[model samples]
Target chain A: MTYCLGMLLKDGLVMISDSRTNAGLDHIAVFRKMTIWNEPGDRVIVIAAAGNLAITQEVIHFLHVGVTLPDEEEPKTIMSVTSMFEAAQLVGAAVRRSYRIDGERLEKENSGFNCSFLIGGQVGGDKARLFQVYSAGNFIESTADTCYFQIGEMKYGKPILDRALSYDTKLTQAGKLALISMDSTLRSNLSVGLPLDMAVYHRDSLELGMHRQFDEHDPYFAEISQRWSKSLKDAFLALPDPSW
Target chain B: MTYCLGMLLKDGLVMISDSRTNAGLDHIAVFRKMTIWNEPGDRVIVIAAAGNLAITQEVIHFLHVGVTLPDEEEPKTIMSVTSMFEAAQLVGAAVRRSYRIDGERLEKENSGFNCSFLIGGQVGGDKARLFQVYSAGNFIESTADTCYFQIGEMKYGKPILDRALSYDTKLTQAGKLALISMDSTLRSNLSVGLPLDMAVYHRDSLELGMHRQFDEHDPYFAEISQRWSKSLKDAFLALPDPSW
Candidate 1:
């Protein structure tokens, strides 16, 4: 299992993902789940994936090579996409292609075809966009009313995002919200472990504004995790008891 | 769908459950998921269930009557059980009997035999206890190290419990923790709904100490929910931002 989420805010986009995957407890391993495609001033697309590692890797491979659509003069890669919407289409097509090859085999083995992706970034002059692409290759774009998308092991961290995020949030604050959400998940679930990859995109910059990895000992994350826990306990203790 | 949790604490026991069940989004209804059997001064057992309503109801009926063991002189009901452990076994036996009658047929229809329970309380001289009974009726008791168990739609509400609960927590504090946990689930998932049923048992008393139902309009619950949200937002804001 994995946990990946992305926010589409007024100033830009924030994408975050944990780097733990496992077939079972004994087979746990670390695998980076976020991929960044940077083409300088033209486009900067960040994709975070969760689900079967093999399937996700195949989809990523397909995207790296390029995705061909019917009637298209040539294959379109993330770097070549004209808009964020087109980039999402390219990723969805790759997911469908991988499904076409492996879905039947997985079904026969009683292993469900489970994979999903969060695609968010800017392309040329288009505004930053966020989308959640499902296992079936279909997708839904996030709007101001729903400015974020989460995939895999999502429930544990969702209440925070539901209460804290909005489309108008500043890029820096959005990044903090994303980390706080991830911190909640890491504490509760072993399937989602650390060494997180995050990309903070500033709208119209077309450059990877800030991309960093948080390991188990990263000081800032350590501070956030410890301080958040203490603050929650303090806050919980402060609430007036039910006047029963 | 539902969310129910029980904590076995040093002072007593705390049990909380939501009152919503649904076949789908359109077919939701309010059905109390908790039941209490108190032979005051002798035994007090609170049972909270989650999963197929029909199956859980049948199991409750069986427990109401009695469950026969191969060597027992007669069927044993919760009221007649010798210990909290025995009472748990009685409930498990009832669950198995219900499964014998319906599990195969449910599987034939692809509905799947899905159900689980949390049983907690005290009997006679026995200490307060908590057990999580699985769909198969097998159960494991909570100890000083792990004193709480959650059944059904549990993840969204679990982090708070993990961070706040301990066996030494007072019964009142445990009740507050349970409500905080339930509040998070209610905000994050539509399946787990309001009008929560809660019971606070004081050890050695052997009777139901405090039992209450919190509806959507319940004043105290409303205050707790509102205050908790505000506290979380404030806590998040207090955390130092990533120095990147």
Candidate 2:
């Protein structure tokens, strides 16, 4: 299992993904789940994937090689997409390719075709966008009413995001929210482990300005995790008890 | 769907269950999920169930009518169970009976034989106990290391319990924790709704000292829900920002 989330904020976009993947408790492994396709000043597409590692990797491979859209003479990679919406379409096409290649085979082996991606970034002058691409290769773009998307092991961390985030939230604050959300998930779920990848896309920058990986010893993440836990406990204690 | 949780604390037991049951989002109804068998001074058994409402109701019915135990000369009722463990076994027997009556019929209609239970209370001289009974009629007791059991839509509220709860927690504190946990789930999930039933059994009392139902207009629950949201937001803001 994995957990990946992205927010399409008015100022920009924030994306975060956990690196741990496990087929079972005994077969746990660490593998980076974030992929960035960047052409500075032109387009910067950051995607975080969760679900079957093989399927997500295959989808990423197709995106890298360029996926062909129907009626289009040439294949278009994330770098070639003219806007964030087109980039999401390109990602969706790659997901479709992965399904075509592996879905049936996995089903035959009694495995469900499980894989999802959080695509968020800007293309040239287009505003930063966020989308949750489904296992079926269909996708839903985030809007003001729902500015964020989360896939895989989402429930544990969702209440915080649901309560705290909005489309107009500051980019840096959004990044912090994403980290806090990830921290909650990491603490509650063993399948979602450490070494997270995060990307912060400033609005209209068309460049990946801040892409960082946080390992166990990363001081800032460590601080956030520790402070958040302490703060929760403190907050819980401060609440008035039920009158019996 | 339903959300019911029980905690076995050194001071006593805390059990809470939401009152919503839904066949689908449109077919939702308010149905109490908690059952209490109070033989005050002798035994106090509280059971909360989740999953197919019909199946759970059926299991409760079997328990009320007295369920036949393997090789037993007479059926055993929850009121007659001598120990907390036997009360759990009696509940499990009811689950198996429900399954025997409805499992194949539900399967034939493409529905699952889904249901689970959280049983917690003290019986006679036994220490306060907690067990999570499964659909298969098998059950697992809570221990010092893991003193809480939550069945149905559990993930949304689990992080708090994981971080804050332990066997040594006071019964009242555990009740507060359970309420906070339920509040989180109620906020995050539509299926787990209001009008909750809560039971707090104090150690060695062997009586149903506090069993109350909080409806939508309940002031205490409303206060907790509103204050918790505010407290969480305050806690989030108090955390340090990412050192970007």
Q: Lowest summed-lDDT stretch of 10 residues in model 1 chain A?
A: A69-78
Candidate DockQ values, in order, are: 0.83, 0.81
- B42-142 per-residue lDDT for model 1 (tens digits): 88899999999999999889888889754677898777888888888887888888889998999999999899999999888988889988988889999
Error of 2 at A34 (Å): 0.5
Point out where model 2 deviates above 4 Å: none
Which digits, one per residue and each the tens of the lDDT, describe model 1 over residues A48-69?
A: 9999999999999988889885
Q: Give the distance in Å from residue B157's predicted Cα in candidate 1 to where it truly belongs.
A: 0.9
Please give the interface root mean square deviation for model 1, in Å.
0.9
Tens digit per residue, CA lDDT, model 2, A32-86: 9999877888888899999888898988888878999756879987767788788
Task: Give fnat, all candidates.
Answer: 0.79, 0.74
lDDT of each: 0.90, 0.87
Highest DockQ scorer = 1
Clashing pairs in 2: none
